[model samples]
Target chain A: MLNELKNLISKEILLEWRQKYSFGGILLYVVSTVFVCFLSFKKIVDVPTWNALFWIIILFASVSAVAKSFIQESRGRLLYYYTIASPQSIILSKIIYNSFLVCFLSVLSLGVYSVMIGNPVQNLSMFFLTIILGSLGLSSVLTLVSAIASKAANNLTLMSVLSFPVIIPLLIILIKLSKNSIDGIGWSVNYRYFISLFSLDMIVIILAFLLFPYLWRD
Target chain B: MKHWWKFVAVLFVLYAIIAGFLMDVPALPILHETIRNLYFHVTMWMAMMVLMTISLIYSIRHLSGFKNEHDIVASEAANTGLLFGFMGLVTGMIWARFTWGTWWVADPKLNGAAITILIYLAYVVLRNSIDEEQKRAKVSAVYNIFSYIMLLVFLLVLPRMTDSLHPGNGGNPAFSTYDLDNNMRMVFYPAVIGWTLLGVWMMTLKIRIKKIKLKKGL
Candidate 1:
């Protein structure tokens, strides 16, 4: 299973490497959005505003990015994959790859956003932790929804509708944790947020692992 | 005796309606007489949760067995759950209007309620978007189970973490913490079961009707 997962993930990466423009497009998306925010906000001095705007940007970028993950796959390709790989490894690989993509996009956005909006985050490490968990949670849920929306033959709108409810709680936690970190709150006061975010990620990944096989069926 | 549970469900609801109003409540300051809404409003949510659970179970069963009946049951249960969820929302709004001096507030309870409603609505949308019978059932069932667990984490776990973050509490009463008086408990507990059974009854009715339509080749 582990070897299959690695092979599948590398296949995804190889595909992504061959399509450099797709990755570049997402990177440009993040930079352009932050530039737009910078133009509008001028310079956000409020910690809460900075935190909220940052997450919203990340959320939108992640959604658009993952919406393409499954929707773009051709039917013939999926059938070929179905024959060669276990559904669990297929989904696990997609999730792992998407998480990396979202994390990279988030980190890129954070740098641009802080430079443009002014860095107000007080505890950088805690903020980074929030970014990591937030990316994983968003990608896992969105990847599953992408597969779902693709199956339904509708793309962006359906993906958004299907993913919004599942993502809201996660978005809330990410915002809260980042808010705490922005205010330089200590770990003792913020451990619950950390624990809940971690558990939420675990639940999504586990559910995707279990449920994707059923979806794999034609 | 075949429909004995249905009879008991009606009995419990009637008892709750009569006793919930006439029974003495602890006359808290803002809640005042509106505490009576507790039986009706809160029970709607409890019932919705129960029906959603039923839907989730049927979804899992459908995945396991690939039976059309399980899919019908899962979809109808979600439909019934949405009905109860809307009822819960409207009733809560009315209660909140009188007590909170607004029809809506940025309360976590409202957030939780809204998300569940959206999730199920998305489930319905997902069902409608698919053209193939088996594919619709399989995909929506996977989605049904996926969203249910996400709902659980959001409603059950997120609140505790957010409670300290927002000490204002939005004037939202923590019923479990301070405790419900014995008198209210008498009606409240029964109301929970009564409405939940009523939801299940409606769901079964929907499933039967759907089966009939399918049989008629509709």
Candidate 2:
């Protein structure tokens, strides 16, 4: 199972590599969106507003990058996976792949956002920790959601409709957490948020693992 | 005989409605009379939660057995849950308007409630977007489980980490925290059971209607 998961994760990475346009497209997406934010706000003077805008950009970027990638996995590809892999392996690999994918994309987005908009984040390490947690939570839920949506009409709108509500809660916490980081608040004020965020991620990952087998079957 | 709970539900609900208005003693400032809403407004949320939990349980059963009957029941329960959620939202808004002087506020619990509504609305939309029978059932059940857990994270886990305007959340006086006394509990507990049973009754009725339609080739 470990080997199968490793191979599946590598297969995803290889596919993303071979189709560099998709990878480059997500990068361009991040840069362009940050540019748009920069254009509108000129320069956000308020730290909380800046924090909120940054996470919002990351949210949209992840939605576009991760979910679209899952949607494009193709019926034939899923069928091929269905033949060779256990459902647990498939979902685990997809989640692992998307987590790293979105994690990288969001980090890049953060860089672009801070460059264009001015970085006010006071605690760099704590903020990075939140980003890592944020991406994992976002990708795990979106991967399961896209898998469910893919089995349906394949309507792209359905993906947004399904994912946004589920994602909003995570976003609220992430914004609060990062806001704390931007304010340079000490970690004592943050352990609760950290615990909640970590537990939330665990809950989502566990749900995806347990429920994917049912979804993968005919 | 087996349907005794329906009679009990009706009896309790009728009593709650009548007494909820006529028998309130607390006279707190701002929320003096409106405290009576605890029986009506808050119970809607309780019922919604109970109904959604039932829906989640049935979704798991559907996934395990691949039974169309269980899927139908799951959807119906979720439908009823959504109805209760709407009731809760409107009542909450009304309650908020009178007390908070606004139709909405940026609070964690309110945001959580809004997210809960959206998750189930997405669930309903997901069910509609799929065309195949077995595929829809299987796919929706997986989604039902996944979204429910995420919603739980928002509703249960995240809110505890933040200060909120809602009672039982922060230090705000809870409709007379000192006097959530037996007087209130007498009505509140039965009201909760009454509304939840009423939601279940509605769900079961819809399930039977669906089964009949299926039998009739509709």
Candidate 3:
């Protein structure tokens, strides 16, 4: 199982490498959105707006990036995967790969956002930690939602519709944790948010693992 | 004989309507007469949550047993739940406008409730988009389970993380904490049960109609 998962993960990575435009397009998406925001505001905004806008940018970017995790695959390719890999490994690999993709994209966006808008984050490490946690949670959710939406003919609107509402809870926690980081709050104050984010990620991941087989079979 | 619970639902709701209006309520500062809405408005949400849980359970059963009957029950229950959710939202909005002087408040609890409704709306959208029967059932069942977890986290966990205008979350005092006098409790508990039973009855009727359609190939 471990070996199969590793192979699947590498396959996903290889597919991204070969199809560089898709991944590069996501990067370009982040940079352009940050630049657009920079143009709109034309001046550094308050900390609250800065934090909110940064996550909003990351949220849309990650949604576009992760929505393709399943939808981009042709029917023939999905059928091939169904025959070759177990559903558990398939979902796990997709989640892991998408998490890596989103985390990298979010961190890149964070850098670009800071450069363009001026960073208000007080605790850089903690902010990055929240970003990573947010990435995992978003990828876990969007991967499954992408799988579900793909079955309905890769409708992009359906992907957003299915994922946005489901992602709000995680988004709220992420924003709160990131806000605390901006305030440079102590760990005691921030730890519960961390636990909540982590637990939500685990719940999403476990739900995907158990439910993917049913989606896989049909 | 088997339909006795439906009779109970009717009686309880009738009692709630009469007593909820005529019964004396505590004289509160902001919510003087509007406190009676708790019996109707809050119970709509309670019924929604219960109906959605039933839908989630049927989705799980569909995944495990691959029974189309379970899928029917799941979808119908979700449909009925969405009706209750909409009612809850409208009622809450009216209450908020009266009490808080705004039709909308960006409170976490309010946003959570709205997001919960959107999640289920997406579920129904997902069902409609998929044309293949078996695939629709299986895929929607997967999405159903995924969204239910997300809904719980959104409605239950996320609200507590930040201060909210809604009672029972954060520092706000619950209606039950002080305002739900014995007079209110009698009507409140029965209102909850009555509405839930009523929603379930609607769901079962829809499910039966769906089952008949499936059997008739209509």
How well does candidate 1 reproduce the true complex, by DockQ?
A: 0.82
Q: Is the docking of candidate 1 incorrect, acceptable, medium or high quality?
A: high
- Superposed model 3: Cα runs more than 4 Å off: B170-173, B177-180
For residues A5-94, write the lDDT of model 1, one tens digit per residue.
Answer: 999999999988999998888899999999998999898987778888888888889999888889998889988997899999899999
Global lDDT of model 1: 0.88
**Cα miss at B170, model 3 (Å)?**
5.0
- What residue pairs are clashing in model 3? none
- Interface RMSD for each candidate model? 0.7, 1.1, 1.1
Question: What is candidate 2's CAPRI-style docking category based on DockQ?
Answer: high
- Give the least accurate 10-residue stretch of model 1 chain A, judged by summed lDDT: A113-122
* Global local distance difference test of model 2: 0.86
Give per-residue CA lDDT, model 1, range B89-200, as digits (tens): 9998898789868888876768888999999999999999998999999999989999998888888777765443122353445575225588888888888898888888
Q: Which window of ten consecutive residues has the lowest lDDT sum in model 2 chain B?
A: B173-182
The interface RMSD for candidate 2 is 1.1
